[model samples]
Target: MPASLSKGGAARLALLLFLSLIVLVFAVASATAIGDYNIALTTVFLSVTNELGLTGADIPPIEQSVVWNLRLSRALIAALAGAGLALCGAILQALLRNALAEPFVLGVSAGASTGAVCVIVLGIGAGSLSLSLGAFAGAFAAFGLVALLSNGATSGPNHTILAGVAASQLFNALTSYIVTTSGNAQQARDVMFWLLGSFGGVRWPDFQLLLVVVLFALAVCILMARSLDAFTFGDEDAASLGVPVARIRLVLFAVTALLTATIVSMVGAIGFVGLVVPHAARYVVGPMHLRLLPASALTGAIFMVVADIVSRIIATQQTVPIGVVTALVGVPFFAIILYRARPQA
Candidate 1:
């Protein structure tokens, strides 16, 4: 697809984005309402509106508290995490020209988990380094390792995927070793649950932080959308077309690291939003980054909020790890991609 959209295409994209926004709002509300203690959908709306000072509707204090204090934050964070991951996946797919490129597949999420464990268990930097910062460093480290193993960005998709698998195993094992050797039983339990992914510990502060990171990253990516479109062809083609290939790649890699690290720090290492959402978005919006980035963000937000809801209800009185829910959906999608990409007989 061309970087620029035709007039009719642009109008269709706008309509799609507008409709997706509405769906995202509904998805978030549904997520907020369908927890262990059910809150009515109307109550969910009034609770949110009341908090915003938009209405003075009478709502039960407990319902209000749950909606405003707990579920709302989690839903918002889930939305942001999904959007961020999807954006990372879209950007990476373009930069690498590989459909399977994403944070989870690239081992960025595992690397971030290892870094977070370093802070929580080993107390890396002795109380100076924040978990997000540590994860950012570790994410980049993993990226660097993959780059080395695959012989830089020019490596074939199979080689890159192999490098990512190696990185994931290495970081996951390191995380386990650190917890087992340094952490107590209680800490071990907490770390293990977190590594698998959870939204239970998040609050408004987390939502606020993630909101900023995701929105800022989206804006940056949007501005670079044309460059990303150029990248889909090849680095040589991109360079020939006046794109500064090296700088754009570095900046985008940094953005991806920042997003993956922040999300892993806050919500643990959730997977597959990055892998699955972008492809789905591209199906809807076509492959232009200008349209695809926002489409991915909206689609991702909806997908994750729905996943979070499933995690709550899938077990009797127990919340499955959000990662597990995503993996269930993602693993099938992953297999499909692999089969489709397989060489013809």
Candidate 2:
């Protein structure tokens, strides 16, 4: 690399870091001050402190349970889901040569949601492990359909998304038939909120598991940044340049499926993070995949955390669904981008 280009990269990185910090401070402050659904941000922070034995005053075990087991778990889970979605979307857009591509565009989320509903509505998950396994299977099925339809990597962008759409419609139809045919009022309620998505009812073990999964996904995204950058020049071009296109695509898809399934099983099908955050990050950092990947990951984590905070605070005594909050935030931004994007030459 030229000396000037190296210097330019450093300057841009510094600017990204400074901007990210400002966003983080605002997110922490907003999360700390806003109140409504149940507890204020200060209370949430103090509760965390109390759990860690860092608080000056002694609080009851119940208080610790409430903060650590429920709220904090939800916050972290939201962050994990967001980061995973955004990271995957960043990879997919480059790989597919499709600007409209997103992590869920291939119906992985729909398939996972279908599988989860089967468990929730059918009393299938005897344990948490079963739930995760089931969701992963469903996500894998969705991706499998895509791969097969594409004839093991010969398929184009539209063909893959089309395959995903067809599979999703089938899953949705099955899900609807199952729900309607079962005629179980109790199960219907579970399915409804699961689709709406919330961080409620989490435990300490689940929280730890979410943290580990997210860290692993983040690591993979960082390591694969070079491969993603290779994708910018188009697949054939990259291949001529000695990039192993098929191998990299397979690896990315598997990692994304794993990450997406892990989150779906835990947090349900929260929307917009994967679809919105990557684009926003690109707007911030331009189209350098190496930087874009990590930048998107951070942007997504913060985006969901803030959205979750707002969801908790928007209503008195009742929490809004985080999915709804995400859609509310993402839609307008998406529209603006669509309007502003230039025509491809």
- For model 1, the superposed segments whose C-alpha errors exceed 4 Å read 1-3, 123-137, 140-167
For candidate 2, write residues 175-228 as lDDT tens digits: 788788873898887787777777776566776787787788778867767667
Any runs in candidate 2 off by more than 4 Å, and if so which?
1-8, 11-15, 18-22, 25-47, 53-56, 60-62, 125-130, 341-345
Instruction: Encode model 1's per-residue lDDT on 68-102: one tens digit a residue.
Output: 99999999899998889899999989987889888
Give the C-alpha miss distance for residue 20 in model 2, angstroms: 2.4
Stretch of 10 with least lDDT, candidate 2: 29-38
Candidate topping lDDT: 1
The lDDT of model 1 is 0.87
- The TM-score values for the models, in the order shown, are 0.90, 0.87
> Best TM-score goes to which candidate?
1
